[model samples]
Target: MSPPRRSELEMRKELVRLRMEMQRQQLDYHAEPLRHPLRQLGHLFAPGRAARGKGTPLAFGGVLLLTLFGKRLGRFGKLARFALEVYPLVSAGLRQYRESRPPKPPQAPPKPQA
Candidate 1:
């Protein structure tokens, strides 16, 4: 047989490197400990997607309708004023709820010798 094509040789080398890299990554991931602080920090700032069945077509349609006829559907400047008033109250309620919650109790130590 003639010498192997240059493209074929390069392809085989890349495939071997990818397989080795994937195994190394998998081992590193499995050896690491799971930490919750990073996850909690992320959750604090992100808005999660709504649960299934909660985002119905009618809700989307209502948002579309509000956007399409935004000014004509409401009294002059009332909708903007209402949004301004409601957002702060909702934020305050959430803050108070988080602050007033009790701290987690400590875990018991292992039993001592008899």
Candidate 2:
């Protein structure tokens, strides 16, 4: 006998329901212990918190997410910087290439709506 496997749709619905439950729990997120790393971040950024501006607890949760996932963010930062440096050259080359192309014939104007 083998364990039952769930369909992709069943797994997806379960994931969505779990996420919604988590979101509802997060509405009272900051009232949890400040000593915890995530709640400590909540203290750091929640508006009227003195350390940072008055931000809604739910909105400020992103800061806690960054705290929890900092290594991944640091890796992404390097990629972002390289992309930023390349963006200007890519855009300028694209602009010049487009400018060199022959213009298209103008389309007939649409008849006025009734």
Best by TM-score: 2
Which pairs of residues collide in candidate 1?
Answer: none
**Candidate 2 C-alpha lDDT tens digits along 1-114:** 999999999999999999999988885563344347665665555565532223446535554554455347786745654654455466667878899999999999999999
Worst 10 residues of 2 by lDDT: 50-59
Residue runs of model 2 more than 4 Å from their true location after superposition: 1-72, 109-114
Cα lDDT tens digits, model 1, 12-101, are 999999999999998776443233435533432345423212334654444445444545667744565465335546656776788899
Q: After TM-score superposition, what is the CA distance of residue 6 in candidate 1 from its true location, in Å? A: 5.4
Task: Determine the backbone clash count of candidate 2.
Answer: 3
- Candidate 1 wrong stretches, greater than 4 Å: 1-6, 34-114
Global lDDT of each model?
0.57, 0.62
